[model samples]
Target: MRGFGDLEAEIMDRLWSWGRAATAREIVDDLQLRRPLAYTTVTTVADILHTKGWLRREKVGRAWVYEPTCTREAYTAQLMHQALETTSDRAGALLHFVDRMSGDEASALRAALEQVKERDTP
Candidate 1:
């Protein structure tokens, strides 16, 4: 899928951070604290997100409640995969990334790898 526009990204951020289905009014209210935005603007963006398949909404009390179709982590993983695809030497790039990880992150990666190995052992 294509990346989001600035306003669209902000709208998604609000949905992911809110961690619940929310009406356009709620998103607009949250965003308004940073700057002014009209309710229709938010509503339009939410509808656009729904059309893009990034959000799904249901009608509730004459208003549409929107929520992300994918979790932030899932989106993040897709972006990371996309980044890796740009490199000619994927393995070398991944290795370099691993080499730069903090100690705790490295430990977690090692533990995750071990779990995968165990699962594959039958």
Candidate 2:
């Protein structure tokens, strides 16, 4: 899967941050605080996101409420996986990636690896 476009990323960021369903009008209003955006434009983009399977929508009263189909973390992981798939040497790429991580991030990676190892042990 590909990453979100500019407008798509804005909408997704708001929905993921709120952690709740929202209508296009609500999103437009929130985004308006940062920059001018038309309600119709936001609605169209939101509809596109729904068609792309990045969002799920339900008709509530007269408005359609939209929510993210997956968390931001899931999207980031998918992007990372996609990046790895493009590399000829995945291990070398991963090593370079790890080398750029902060101490806390490195520790977290180590902890996560240990958890996966434990889970895979039979």
Q: Assess every candidate by TM-score.
A: 0.86, 0.97
Model 1 lDDT tens row, 23-121: 998999999999999999889989999999999999999999999999998998788898899999999999999999999999998998999999999
Error of 1 at 51 (Å): 1.3
Model 2 gets an lDDT of 0.97
- In angstroms, how far off is 88's CA in candidate 1? 2.6
The lDDT per prediction is 0.93, 0.97
Q: How displaced is residue 58 in candidate 2, in Å?
A: 0.0
Question: Candidate 2, which segments miss by more than 4 Å at Cα?
Answer: none
Say which candidate scores most in TM-score: 2
Question: Can you tell me which runs of candidate 1 are displaced by over 4 Å?
Answer: none
lDDT of 2 at 57: 99
Best by lDDT: 2
